[model samples]
Target: MTSAKALLLLLILVNQQLLTADAELISLTTGAIGAGAVGAFSAIFGTYSYIKCKFNECCDDNWIPGNVAHKLQQEVDEKLYGQHIAQETVIRAVRAHVSKLKPSKALVMSFHGWTGSGKNFVAKMIAKSVFKKEMLSKYVHLFVATLHFPHPEEVEKYKEQLRSWIHGNLTLCDRSLFIFDEMDKMPYQLSIFLFLSNGGMNAIVEKTLENYHSGQSREAITYKEMEQLIKNSAFNEGEGGLKTSRLISRHLIDYFVPFLPLERRHVIMCFKDYLRSRGFPTNADEIEELASQLHFFPKSSPIYSVSGCKQVEQKVDFLYSDYVHEHYKKHFIDDL
Candidate 1:
């Protein structure tokens, strides 16, 4: 029998013998036998527990330890494009929070930027760093505002359900991660309950321009400056769910991360990366052609991508579909 089965069987046998000995215990021989049975049972139970925890997701073994900060930094550097400020802020925040033995409260960060500027991408990276199964892990919960709370009128109902869901998940695993996407679409009432959003797009763009015009490098923008701008924007912006929300009023958010608009060069990098990931040719000319297909903003300067890398995968797939079909026909259909 396998070791687990063997151990289980041995445990059952030992329990039965101990019970029988207990019923007639009095003699020294019986006492000695009972003591030995107890010892064996304890050892077998310990061994079984160790095996179960090691091979199963029943314990801390399934969670990534604090050392994952280093891995997260490396992955962000290699994979994530643009948003230098976000890269540094996230790495530092996560490293500091995870390293703490007893954090006073949950680490809450608000990512702000225009659509497709890597807000969700960074969240996924954080999830991957902390959970073995990454975004698919039971500990990771993703709730899209539009999908989960469609009715703004039923804000109270959604709040209760959301609260219960978070509590239930936390009970199951204290390390649970709850990601709320499209926070701008969520009802303002629900803002106080969760921790996520995309706000301050205009302010971010304006600040970036101001810095550039002032002869300052974009990379020199500090977290403090970006944080203040994002906070002000979220507070004053009517469309954002976080406007006047208790989370911001009470200073509950730990960091307000800004994802700068992706420039043409960054979008090109994204195209090449996607192509390489899908086993497609990373030809410089072809990649440039693919990137040129994307729409850039500010008709005058035409610097940043209008859609960022959001549509990159779709564009790449569409570009290759016909080629793939013809290649299949040539290699497989011709042989038939």
Candidate 2:
């Protein structure tokens, strides 16, 4: 037991302690690396799952899609000129329905009015404003009754097909909009038609031979019949009632908006709007002069446009062209 022996023992203990420390450090470093590897693997797997779900049917493209209420309000306020009440009602109804937690029913609106009134225009506006891609959305369906159901004998078949179409679309997406135009011309049975009124190449037109007395009639359903038909199609509770149309009963009719005939003032406003959209000057004098040229019913009838701006754009085009020609004559050509 000398000093040298004691020193050697101390050195051995020191070396053993250093070895233990190195082993502990290595263990800690390995644990950290293992945890980092697990995290990396988890991140890669999560990203792949996300991409797959996005590409597949797991994610709906239009789930809680656009701010429909705001867009509708904006569209109506900006685009629709002389229908304040109609515009307001459309915005309110659309916003309310879209705001619901789970809207069990579709908003059914009936637009009725004279031929050239803004019924179809407003209907299309509603559809476009509600969806992100507007009318192009897969959920929006436009059906013109006169275009869809020409043959009266095929009414029942149209009914079944309509029902199936509605069911199928709703199944795919509950937020679908089915817009039926030309309700005034619809058959009493609430079915479908082929639109022959367009005068297009594909449209069906009635012609009478001088030798033959037989021809297709263009008789429209009376207003009373139209009312009954609408009630039967939209409000009936079940398919078993006296009113057997389940399409309307199954879906809720949110509003029945009637487009009243446009007065001369409304027509003037439409003219101004059209002018502004076309980047033309819409001064009071110009609108009045243009309005005077439009033909109204009852030769003395307060100068109202019965066609409700139907011919305004074309008339404007003609007027503008004349104006341009006159300007050239007054300035460039006359100077020469």
Candidate 3:
């Protein structure tokens, strides 16, 4: 009986050990499953939020917030000088288009013309009006085509990548703004990827011409004329034809705004802007003097600023440097 009791006790101990091991394994499995479930839920929630914002026009980082649309119009008019009619048209068009919460198509604006004619400046204004951080927003993708794809051989690769990038960003947020700087430099075939109009996806594309001939007599074609021109160019296989010509032949360009060469008045206005930006008071006489001193190229037939407003600030700094030197020479003559 004592032996039987000892055997029973040993069996009970063995069963208890086995139960403890099973309990430990069950606890570990439950813990792992719970952790996985939490992670998955977090991912799902994040994705849902992103999709919700895209559809509702309330992207966390992209869409223009309340009152910004109106403010943007004012800022564009005030800051972008000498482009009065253009600015008004842009403001009107953008405001009207964005008022529709769900636009079926993306707003595409093509800015072409002389250098320093506010093509890029207007683009930045549009971005600022739409986003809180404006150009700095994650949703704003600025691509210089020439800088991005330098080799002709990389055209195919660039096309695929560009398409994927646009599609992926649009999927994440339809309100994405893409600035294609130097659109003229973009390989014709590669540029076709940008005009893809897939349903349920929308984005703003601003294309700027960076390599255009200064002072070329362009007829300032309207959007309709541009479309017609594309059709003719593609069908006729005309000079300056693009591989993507066929694709853009029927594409609807929302706006094809042309920037004209800056006149002396415009240059003066630009200098004032530059001075103001650098915390200098806008003195009319000083601005006029600087504008007059700016040399134009092709001395006989001048149409645009030699360097646009690009060198205006540099000129201002030089003048200030001269002033400082003169003052020092006059004050410290004895010491010298």
All-Cα superposition RMSD per candidate = 7.1, 18.6, 13.8
RMSD of 3: 13.8
Tens-place lDDT per residue, model 1, 1-336, is 433344445655644543333422222233245556566657767886677667655427555455668888988998888799999988998888777766778887778887789988888888888878788877778888889898888978998897787787777667767787876654311111224565688899888877877998889999888988887786577755567566666877788889998888889888988898988898888888888899987787787888989989998999999887888889997798
Task: Give the poorly placed runs of model 3, Cα more than 4 Å off.
Answer: 1-58, 61-64, 185-247, 297-303, 321-336
Ten residues in a row with the worst lDDT in model 1?
186-195
> Whose lDDT is greatest here?
1
lDDT, candidate 1, residue 89? 88
Name the best candidate (by TM-score).
1
Q: How do the residues 126-237 of candidate 3 rate in per-residue lDDT, one tens digit apiece?
A: 7777777678876788887658877767778988898888888777566777887765434311111122111100110111111124432233323443333333333233
lDDT of each: 0.76, 0.54, 0.57
Ranking by lDDT: 1, 3, 2
lDDT-better candidate, 1 vs 3: 1
User: Candidate 2: where is the Cα deviation over 4 Å?
Assistant: 1-64, 184-252, 297-300, 321-336
- The lowest-lDDT stretch of 10 consecutive residues in candidate 3 is 198-207
lDDT of 2 by residue, 124-214 (tens): 6766665555566666677776688776678779878987987777676666667765433332111111111111101101111111224
> Against the hidden true structure, what lDDT does model 2 obtain?
0.54
Clashing pairs in 1: none
Model 3: how far is 291 from its true place, Å?
1.4
